[model samples]
Every structure is written in structure tokens, then in C-alpha cells.
Target: MIFSLPVQQEPKKYAPVRTLMLYLTEECNLRCTYCFVKKEPKYMSRETALRTLDWVLQRNVSGGEYKVLVNFFGGEPFLAVDLMQEVVDYGRLERPNLYKTFKFSATTNGTLANERVERVVREGQLALMVSMDGGAQANRLRPMVSGRESYSLVRKNLPRLAEWARLCTARVTFTPDNLELLKNVRDVLNVAPVGVALCPVVEADWAGHEQALEDAYAELGEWFAAEVRAGRRPPLEVTWELLRDYQQRLICKRRPQKACPLGESLMAVDSQGNVLPCHRFLHRPQQRLGTVEASELPDERWLYAHLKRAEIPDCETCVARTVCGGGCRAVALDGGYGLNEVHPYHCLLMQAHMRLVARLYAELRHDLNFWSGLAQVPTDTLNQELYQLGS
Candidate 1:
């Protein structure tokens, strides 16, 4: 069935697109249980990769932005190392001015952190995010093709991979089975100085597990507080983003205009050069806007129809609507719900998470000693925001 395109609404001005993610291939070495992409042996050719890069450069130039971010994404981007290298080399030579304007990054499964991939990362100064679910047991959901656990392999290579990359961050997806590990995340992942981020298992059977998820978030909050006390600032991505948004709300005394920059200022292109709303929407043909060769993007109305917080019914009255931004659109779409509607489980989780972050911010502001070296936020600004929030 062909889904009808969304009706056009009054256009709202937003930032121009400055980030583009390219899915280099759809092949993966590990069989992750919750992976959304349907794995295949397909790899992007040099021609397609270069065309995508040129498209991005043109967009940046037309949008009046000198700098742009080009993300190498995939089932495993390392599988297409040659294609990636070609793109990087081409950018440096063909568009020397725009070459220095490009910032590179990738999300990999961490098993293939070999010398070749390391050289590309170092030369391009890429920020690499490695997928690693907590301890061995928690990582059982992610196994090699031979049905063997991959935790040991990833752990062994993480430090070495961390060395060449500008920054290495761990991305964890927590399912019900591994919810308990949230408390021991640092020890389990073994990347304390590098830092870790959290994401919930999308479309999981969240029945009878709401309380467990809440408790786990609470534990994580305590963990974050401890990290602050110890003068170590781990980049807990989700939490850090939320904390900053919440603080911004208190300081500005107003809600943000948009939740995230997804459709407005960011987009993802699949290996076949089909432009998608985001990387998570890959393989979803219905959501395809156009191809990289197309001169014009899909109308903003169609691209951001479901992304606006005001479009979500529940968000109208939700207290954290400004900060939560109705959660992930991909998760909502996968759950057979409208992109405007958030999953119930995710709603509960975010509510709990926002409260935890607010409480932690309050605690940190009260004690300057806890704020000695942490760089997530400024102490003076946080103190003023806390004062405003209290008033």
C-alpha cells in the first residue's frame, strides 16, 4: 500500500543541513538480535560513494555553511574500507577548500579495528563510536556469525582502536535481560576514560518491565553523580544531552523550537544513495525522500511532518515535552505507531531520566568541589540556572 504524503503545513525556519551520514554497506560480521537493518552482502561502489560526497559538498556550499560533517555508517563501515578511503582522498584533492571543511566519524561493531581502518581514522580525525553492550552476558545478544560471544574480541581491540581515533565512545543498547547491568556499566564495558552512552532496545516486549527500567535509570543517575564526585566526566551522551537541554530551559525561560536537528539540518543516505530521514530509517523504502542525484530535497513538510513536537498529541501537555522531543521517530514508526506518537515504555523511561538529570544537576550546583574538573557544563552557569529553576 502506498502511504499518502503528509499534507503541507506552515513552514517553520530551522538550521540548514550541515551533517550527512552515508551507509557504506549493509554487511555485518556480528548478528545482533535487535539490529534494525536487514543485513546483506551489498557494498557501496566508489562511484556512488563519491557522488554522495559531492552532493553533500554542494549542499553545504549552497546552504552557506563552510563546515560539514560526513559520517561513514553501515552494517560495518570497516567492511567497505576501500570505498571510505577513496571518498576521503577525493575530498582532500578535488575540493581542497571544502576538504578541510569536512569532519568525519563512524559507528562500527568494534571487531574489525585493524591497522587499515585505524590509518583512515587517524588521517581523517574521525570520532568513532563502538557498539558494546555491557558485560559478556549482556553482550550475548550480539554474537559473531559462528554463534560465539564477541565481548572478549571487542574489549581487546577497544584500547588500540581508541589510540588512533580522535575520540572513541561506546554505544550500549539495554534490553530487559541486561537492565541490571546499568549499575555496573563502566566495569562491564571497560572504557571508563572513553565514556559510554545508552539506548533502549527498540520494539522490545516491554510488558512487566517498566519498573525495572525505571530502577535501572535511577541507578544510572547515581552512577553519574558518583562520576562527578570523582572528577571524571564520562560523556554519557543521552543523559548529557538531556541535562544540557533542561538547563537551557531554566536559563532561557522558554522551550526550544525543535527537538533535534534530524530532518531540518541533518539527513542520512543509504548505500544505494537513497536519502532517508535518518540512519535508523534505512531499508524503509516508504520513507525515502529522493536520491543523491536529485537536485531538490523532498518538501520540508513531508520530511518533517512527524518530527515536530507540536504534532504529537501527548506532547501538547507533557511537562518534559521540550526536552524529550517525543523520543525517537524510528522507534515510534517500528512499533506500528505514528511518528508523532511515542512508545509508552519510552515515555516512562524519559520521564524518569529527566527527573534524575534535574536532581543530579541540583546536587552538583550545591557543591562546587564536585564541579572541579568536569567539563560537561560550566559551574557558574549551572549555579545560576539552578537558582532560576528554584525560583
Candidate 2:
């Protein structure tokens, strides 16, 4: 079976800044080995938290932005729950018009989740993302402050966390050491139906592990294909991303111009009120566009010139460029490569993933009934939509 590629449309104008990532504190309960940020004792003060919220709200209101996604980030955001609640309450009371415009999210190690945190999440005020790398053995890299295994502690809270939050996601970081644990990803998926995002460990030497990584992804791809054939929807980030790209290409005939929202529609603010392009650039001083006190809007022209996918020479000719969005810019920068050049390991992993997903899609398309049942949308309606798109 052969799949025809859709004609690419002209790139659209850059979207306005709508995402604000507030790194609540540098304090954390876990000592993850691959942690990018150098953990510190500094925490965001209430005054600074309020100022950050006000700055984001002012931008949305003045820029005529429809919605603002406020992501609470940290070494662990739950450590500063008081500050988070104050900001949420202020948004509700002081900025009533923008109250509904605000959407809250957080990423945590799931160590400090309690009744208070549950209440906030249950109230539909926040969506929490828990970091759990596969099973116990794989999670050894993310130990507690006392250097104890944290998998059980995190696993114990999954049920309660799932019940409390309106939305919850699990993030799994696949390092060279944990490559074998890719098969155990289902263990995390079972805990949270929302899905598990598989991220490769950056800034490490992945030179000889190309074949191993490819084999692991192939196995994972086979598992995903089997689950889909069984009429069960399994939450796997890799599979979902490929499926989304397939739909966008075949149905919408359009591709994204940028890989990430950083420096474009997203910005991250540190504890001291210093603004950077994204959370990944927290410690990198040179990447700091400006501080919240100095500038309300990011320098889009500079950001576009520096971070746009089109600026990447290699991506211009790569077949998978549109789908991979030229990979992560932060990872490229960390690997001592230009923002336009993707890390070799990432490039290999993406190529393997695309091959596997393409094979699975081809097999599914051969069976008309199975393909029709895969998505919630009716077959006739989907066909009509695709027809309109290709017109």
C-alpha cells in the first residue's frame, strides 16, 4: 500500500503569545539524574508570583488574545502551592473578565500531592503532569531527596491524582540506561489513561545506541499496532504524535512552521522574575530575551530569525521535517549544534518512529472497516472532510 503526500500550503503568520510558564521555585523533592536545572533553595515570592500573573494577564487583555495557558513549573510546583493558589484566586477575583481566559497546568514528581492539591485540581482549576519513567527499575534515576526509590511513592498517588485532576499526563524520560524499560511504558499508561510522553535524554552521548533505540521503538510500534487492532485505545505519545501528523497531512494538507512554542507563542519566567524563551533555557543567561519588568512582549522578529524551522538548512530537504518540526531547539543547542540542526540521535529516533508509524498506518488503511472504526468521527463525515481538504 502506498500513501500519497498532500500538497504543502504556504506558512501561516506566527500566532500571538498566549502561553506563560511560571517556574514557581527551584526547590524539589526528587533528585532526578538527568535534571537540566541545577536545583537551588530559591523559591518564588508571593509578590513576584502576583507580578508575573499580572504581566501575563495584561498582555492577553491588551493584545486581544482569546485564551492564556498558565503553566506552573518548578523543581516541583507543589512545593509552592500557597503561591499557586493565591495567583489563581487573584485571577478569579481581580481579573474577572480574564478569569475564564486563564487555564492552569503543572508538572510535578507527584511526591507532595495531597488533599489541598486534589481540591484545586478537582475544581477544574489545574491540570497536573506527573513524572514517572516506566516501572520501578527504570525510575531509579529519579530518586527522592534522601536517595531512596520514588516509584512506589509516585505510584501510590496515581489513583488519587487521576481522580482529582480534570486532566492528567505522565512523562517518561528514556535515557540510555532505561532503554530496556520502553516495554514497561504500558505500566505507566495503565495508571493514567491520558497518556505518557516519551522523551529522550538530552545532552548525553547517544552515538552507539542508535540500533538499540531503533529496536526499542520498533517493539513499541508493534505493541501500539496490536492495541489499535484489538480496538483498544492505548495512550502512547509517540504513536499519537505520528497519527496527528498523518491526519494533518492527509486531511488538512497543512504543516506547522515551528517545532515548539518557545520564543513564538510561549515564554517562561523564573523565580526572580527573569524571562527566558522557554523553561529549557532557564539557566542559560544568553538566551534571556528580557525580564518581565523590562518588556511585556517578546522580540518576535529576533525569535523568528533565530528559531524558525525554515531557517534550518537541513530541515528544508528532509522528508520528515514537517512532522518532527526539526526536533527540539534546546536539545540542539545543548548538543553544541545550531538551532537549525537536530541532534543526530534525535534524527535517528525520529526516522525510526516515522517508518514504524507509516507501516502501521499502511496496514490499517488496507482494512476499510478497521480504519473507519479507529477514530470517533463517522467514516462518511471523515471522507467528506478529506475530500473538501483536497479540493
TM accuracy, model 1: 0.86
lDDT top scorer? 1
lDDT of 1: 0.69
lDDT of 1 by residue, 1-391 (tens): 1111123423233344566778899999989888887889888878888887676655554356655667788888999987888877766554433432666777888898777898898888877777777778856789898998898888887887778777677777777888866777777446535656676775778788878877887888887788777767655756766677776778776765544456755688888888887777886788887888775676546875656562356666765765765566777788888866677767766676777777888888665544443344434321211111100
What TM-score should be assigned to candidate 2? 0.85
**TM-score of every model versus the real structure:** 0.86, 0.85
Number of backbone collisions per candidate, in order? 0, 0
lDDT of 2 by residue, 155-207 (tens): 88877787777666677777778887677778786675655667667566777
Sliding window of 10 residues with minimal summed lDDT for model 2: 382-391
State in Å the error of residue 115, model 1: 1.4
